[model samples]
Target: MRSDLCSLLGIEKPIFSAPMGGAAGPDLVASVCNAGAYGVIPLWGKPVDQVAAGIDQIRALTDRRFAVNLNLSFAYEDALEACIQAGVHGVSLFWGMEPSAIARAKAGGLVVMSSVGSVAEGQAAEAAGADIIIAQGWEAGGHVWGQVSTMALVPAMVDAVGVPVVAAGGIADGRGMAAAFMLGASGVWIGTRFLASREATIHPDYLTHVLGASEAQTEWYHDLYDVAWPNAPHRALSNSTARAWRDAGAAPPGQRPNEHEIIGTRPGGDPVVRYQSYTPLPGTTGDVEAMSLWAGQGVALVREVQGAAEIVDEIFDEAMTCLAGGPGKPGPN
Candidate 1:
C-alpha cells in the first residue's frame, strides 16, 4: 500500500524505520531499505566526515531510498551539510522545529519530515513546509516532546495539518499499524519494536531487559528531577539507577548523580560506570541485568530477534492482510 509519502520516497510501504541514534547502523538501515521501506540513520553528535562515511556505507549496501535524521536541538547545520554531501534521499528532524531548515532540505530536493507532539506544532510544521509530520506521543522512548498519547495526537495532527501524518510511540504490531492508519496517519515510524531486532547494534543485555519488561516497568524521572527533558516523559526499564533517584527525592541540583560518571566508562577501561546507553555494561559480559534498557510500552509485543528485512516484510504483510479484511497473522519467513 503506497501513500503520497511512499510515492514521494519511491518506496512500496509507508513503514519507516526510526533513525535510532547509536543503535541504528548502516547494515540495519540498508536492510530495511532493501526490503522496500525507508531506513534512517541518526546523525546526532557525529562529525561531518564520520556521517559521510556512514552514508557511504549504506549506499554501498543498497541503492534503495533512505534518509538521515537530524536532531534540531543539536548541531543540525553540520548534519544537514553531511547529508547533502552524502546525497541522502530525505531528512527527518526531531527535538525542536525549524522551518528554514525544512525549506533548505526541500530546496535540495530531499523529502523532509518533522516530529511534533501537539496540534499547534503539527500545524506549524505543515505551514513551515514540512512534507510529513510525525505525531510522537509520550509513550515513545528516548527524548520525548510532550505528554500526549498517540491515539489522541494522531487524529488531531491529521486535522490540523494538510501534510500527511505518521503516528509514532506505542506502535509495534500489525494491529497497531492498522489502528494508526484508521486514526488518519498515512504511515508509521517505529523505534523500540525495531530496536529489539538482531540488526540493531544495541547490547544484547539491553535487548534482554526489554524482552523481560512490562508496560508498568517504565516511569518518568522528570517529575522528581530537573533534567533537560523535564516534564517530558521517557519510557525505560526500571533499574537501580532509577530507584536510587526516586528514593533520594530526585537529588538536589549539584547532588544529582552524574550521568556520565554513573553511566559512562572510566579512564583506562576501569569498570566504574554501570551502563552507557548503547554499550553493554563493563564486567557483566553477557549479563543483561546490570545495564540500562531503553524501550517503549510496545516492548510487550516484541518476543524475538529477527532479521531487519524479515521484520519489515512481516509488518507490511500483516498490515496488508488486515487492510484486506483478513486475519492479521504474525509475520512468518
Candidate 2:
C-alpha cells in the first residue's frame, strides 16, 4: 500500500476523504488528516475570507497536510487565491477542470489535483500540470463526473495519465479499497461513509436514510433538485419532492410544482426553498425527508457511525488482509 501518492502527501494511507460540500466540516477534515489519511476541504461557493477562515481553523487542529477542492462547475477564482494566500498544502479542481486555475494552484506551491470523468480529461489535467487525478465514476454521490464505472474508469485513467490516479464513486469499505488497489489505483476517495462519521454535522435523519437505503433506491438525474444550481446532474435518493416531479412527467426546473417554495430552514435559521442545495444540517427544522439525500451505490455497505480515525484504520487493515490472502479475490464492494 506504500505508494508515491502517500509519500508526496505525507500521509500513511492512500485513502482520501472527498471534500463533500455542505456535508464536511472543519472537525471532520482535521480528523481525517490526523487519522493518517488525506483530508480535503470543499471550497465550493465560499467567499475568500470564509475560505481562509476555514483553512485557519483546520490548521489549528492538525499540523498534518490536507487539501482544498473547488468545484469549477461554479465560480471559484477568488477561492483559489484565498487558498494560496492561506498556504494550503494542495488544491483539487472538479467539474470543469479550469487549466489556468490548476496552473495557479501549482504556481502557489500547492499540489494540484483534478477530478476527471474520462481518460482524456485525466490526460488533459496532467498536461495542464495536475499532480494527481481522481477518477470519478457515475456510481459516486453528489455531482458525478461521468458515466463510467469504477472498475473500468480507474484502470483507464491510470494508464492514460502519467500521474497517480485515485479511484472514487461507489467505494465505501475495505473491500472497496482492496478492489481499488487491484484496479491499479494509487488510492481511493470516500464520501458517503464519512458523512456518517461522528465529526460531520449532517442531520441524524440523513445518516439514518443512508444507513437504511438500498442500492436500488439511489437514482441519478439532471436538474431534478435544481434550485441554487441548475442543469447539473447529481445522484440522490428519490424523496417526495423528487417523486412529485417524476410523477408529473419529470418536468423541467421552471415547470416544476411548488418551485421556489420555502420548505425548510437550516441550522442558521435561513429559509431554504424547495429543491435548493440545502442539506439537513444540525438544528435544521423542516422537511428533512424531502431534502436531497445525496448518496452512492456503495452506500448500502455503510452500517455504522464511527470516528474518522477508526474508519480509516479499519478500512486500511481490512484491505491489507484481503490483499494478503491472494490476487483476484473480490473485495467487499
Tell me the tens digit of each residue's lDDT in model 1 across 22-79: 6788988999999998898887778888888888999999999898988786677977
Per-residue lDDT, model 2, residue 66, is: 93
Model number with the top lDDT: 2
Model 1 bad stretches (over 4 Å): 223-233, 257-291, 329-333
TM-score of candidate 2 on Cα atoms, chains taken together: 0.96
Error of 1 at 225 (Å): 10
- Model 2 lDDT tens row, 1-333: 789999999999999999888788789989999989999989779888899888999999999999998988788888998988888899889989688888889999999989998998998899999999999999998888788988899998887888999999998988899989888899999998898898887888888998898888888887777777776788987788888888888888788888888888888789888888666787888889888888988888888999998989888988888788743336586
What is the model-wide C-alpha lDDT for candidate 1?
Answer: 0.77
lDDT of 1 at 105: 87
